[model samples]
Target: MRLFLTFCAFFALVAVVFAWEKEDHEIFDLVSSIQASEGKDVNFYSWLEVSPSATTAEIAKAPFVQAYRKKSMQLHPDKNPHDKKIHERFARLGVVSTILRNKESRERYDFFYRNGVPVWRGTGYYYSRFRPGLGTAIVFLIIVTSGFQYAAQHVNSRRDLARIEDIVRQARQVAWGPRMVPVEGQRKVKVNLGGGPESEAPERWISMVVDANNVYFLHPDGDMELLDASTATQPAISSTWFIALVRSSYQSAFGRSNDLKEAEGVSPPQADDDELSGTASEAPGSGTVTPREGQTTSTSTGKRKKATKRR
Candidate 1:
């Protein structure tokens, strides 16, 4: 529960950091358009020909109003129809003028003007400003999801390593006794991984061999496998669930195709063997023929000749 709360709090903080009000987005849109239409160094105050610290009262008065009207007339679409972005600039100008006209909106713009707008205003801001295509969105999702999966893998790998270390330590303690002094020869021992003496559930035991500085798994067949950093599963991009699943699926499909090809290749020889056996069974005989016990070979030949002459 505590961990869940911590994660929620973390996401909340991130959301807050990325959060921008609708009014703030309007200001951002205005700033981006003005810079894009005019020059990079031009700002809202300079574009409107007003002072950054100018009072709202001054902005509401004639001088500011006249300057805005003049700029609006110059950027209006009808006056410059050849300019494809003239209407956008004209609309952007109106938004800018409105922001300066209102005291609250003006203050918001002033703050950003002084400090400069943020370079990155989160994905929502960018998505609204420049709508990404499907391909770009998919690539973005893959990158984000893969990054999260990779981070989760690292967290799990650390946990698994800690558990493995604990098990190795327990095995070493059992083999070397209380002092845990380095033993010269390998000593085999069993470590209880789960279920205590008081628990009714069956205990899980792992047999291990301990030497002077190392612990090894003692297999049932008397083979020893060393336990170290390699014993724990490591974190990797390829090990992330999505990528791993894709790779495994591809391998499975390829393996099945190869198996089908092998089956096809092996069939022809078996079919040929079956055909040979069939032909042999269909044949009259394989050995030399002999006459019946009472008949001679010449008598049979004369009878076949007489029968042919009659035909």
Candidate 2:
């Protein structure tokens, strides 16, 4: 019975050691994961750079003085209500803040940081001198299992974010119509006109010739005018009243006579140029002199008279 009890005690001791080893391994793994995520080696000089003149009191007060205070308050156990993760995070934050604040503990931390060494570096001296094969096998198993789990979670998170962004982009495309118009067989032209004091011509002229699909223009005082295709001459008529008459005539001929003013709405087919010109046609004479289609003629009895067409 004595031997059996001793064996049982030994077994219990072995089980406790196994559990402790497992816990330590998990801690090392977590530290490695954090280092990888942070993207840089933990340097000894970094803390000093953050606060070179750090006193014990200053270090202790630093976390609360910084932005982490608001985070801690929000993540505190009581504030978070029933949130287990927030409570765990809050506890971890407190632990980190405490370790970072203590001078002696911080010095040891700085040693590891400067050496680029992990806490498990002296495992051979601290832990039992176990067989190399067994130690390596145990570590390998833990690493493979944990690494697979981490990779799976990381990949899933990236895919989820990508899908969310794609959905948002599609919704935006629907909300705001097509963002671009394809350009094909398109041409652009720019015109420059000389208008300064040194220019020879003081007046500017700008002409858009539809036949040439070209625009010709000058600068400063010149005016731009559009002429009727049929009636306009090269040195175009400059009179405002004649231009208005041409526009009225065009509108009348094109069945857009409704656009004409009452004063200018005479039916062109029924009225001759003499009737259309009205006051302009009359001159101080014996009866009335009216200009014919091709030649100038006199109207004594208001009768039609043929005239030779000018070559």
lDDT of 2 by residue, 92-128 (tens): 5555455557776665555444454443433532354
Best by lDDT: 1
Model 1 gets an lDDT of 0.81
> What pairs collide in candidate 1?
none
At residue 132, candidate 2 shows an lDDT of 56
Query: Which candidate's TM-score is highest?
Result: 1
Segments in model 2 whose C-alpha atoms lie over 4 Å from true places: 1-30, 36-53, 62-68, 77-85, 124-311
Q: Over the stretch 150-200, how does candidate 1's per-residue lDDT look in tens digits?
A: 888788889889988998889878877888877788788899988878998
Model 1, which residues run further than 4 Å from truth? 1-19, 51-65, 76-82, 102-123, 131-138, 198-202, 267-311
Model 2: worst 10 consecutive residues (lDDT sum): 209-218
Clash count of each predicted structure: 0, 3
lDDT of 2 at 103: 77
lDDT of each: 0.81, 0.48
- Lowest lDDT sum, 10 consecutive residues, model 1, at 302-311
Residue 9, candidate 1: Cα error in Å is 5.9
